[model samples]
Target: MSDKALDEEHEKYIKEHSALFANYAKAEFMIKHNYISKQDRLDMAEKQEIALNRVEKQEKRRERLMKQIIPRFVLYFAIMTLIYLFFRWLSMYT
Candidate 1:
């Protein structure tokens, strides 16, 4: 194979196999270098299922308030204010 054809084949192989080998090289490098400490890993593991459940509950509660209650409140306020202004405008004209 010519050098250009070999380069194209290597590129094709890399593109085809990227998903199968995703982050493998980076993991290998990290294992050799050990960037994070064992203590930090233990700290991450301390946040177990209970903590995750609490966080998920809070997220759902916040989502409900944001998606339902707050928007309803704002819509009611805007609609009532507009209706009141329309009545006041009519009363003034009459």
Candidate 2:
């Protein structure tokens, strides 16, 4: 390829392949993806990524809240029952 003659021969070979290239079929060319540019694809990717992050953040917050907080009624009912039993035992025995 360094010599002029070799470069010319490779160029001729590449030209022959280009000459044989076929045009796209009408059905294939009409597909939506074929019409989307790189910037459109990137924009869609960014929107989807933001949505995914939002969902993930909400899920993690929900899980953390579930772990940290107890239902108030259950805790209060148990504590009141124990106090009532303890007082009843004191009244009966003392």
Candidate 3:
């Protein structure tokens, strides 16, 4: 085959099967390099999941606290406004 035709064939093969082969190659490289064992990777992934869940729960708690606090804040402001108006009326009479 001509060099140009061979290149075209290789490109076509990559387009068709690159994802599968790439996954295999990545796993192979990782195992061969011994940078991380499979069990260690799984443990890290599980710890990450737990950490993410804890963060999500804290966010939810903060949101709920804000929801409860906003209405109390509005009520406090309204009560203060009414007290100020009442004192102003008393001053006008004096």
Model number with the top TM-score = 3
User: Ranking by TM-score, best first?
Assistant: 3, 2, 1
| Best-fitting candidate, scored by lDDT | 3
For residues 1-94, write the lDDT of model 1, one tens digit per residue.
3579667855765664573345445544655699767775455446434555655675586577568867788999999999999999999988
RMSD of each: 17.0, 25.2, 19.5
Estimate, for each residue in 1-94, the C-alpha lDDT of model 2 and write its tens digit: 1369657855865664453332123323434557756676676557656755765675687577656555655788899999999999999988
Off by over 4 Å in 1: 1-47
Candidate 3 wrong stretches, greater than 4 Å: 1-34
TM-scores, all candidates, are 0.39, 0.51, 0.56
Ranking by lDDT: 3, 1, 2
Q: 1-94 in candidate 3: lDDT tens per residue?
A: 4579667855755554565456546756776798778896677557656755765675687578769879989999999999999999999999
TM-score: which is higher, 1 or 3?
Answer: 3
Please report, as a residue range, the 10-residue window in candidate 1 with the lowest summed lDDT.
19-28
Worst 10 residues of 3 by lDDT: 15-24
Model 1 lDDT vs. the true structure?
A: 0.64
Better of 1 and 2 by TM-score: 2
Cand. 1 TM to true fold: 0.39
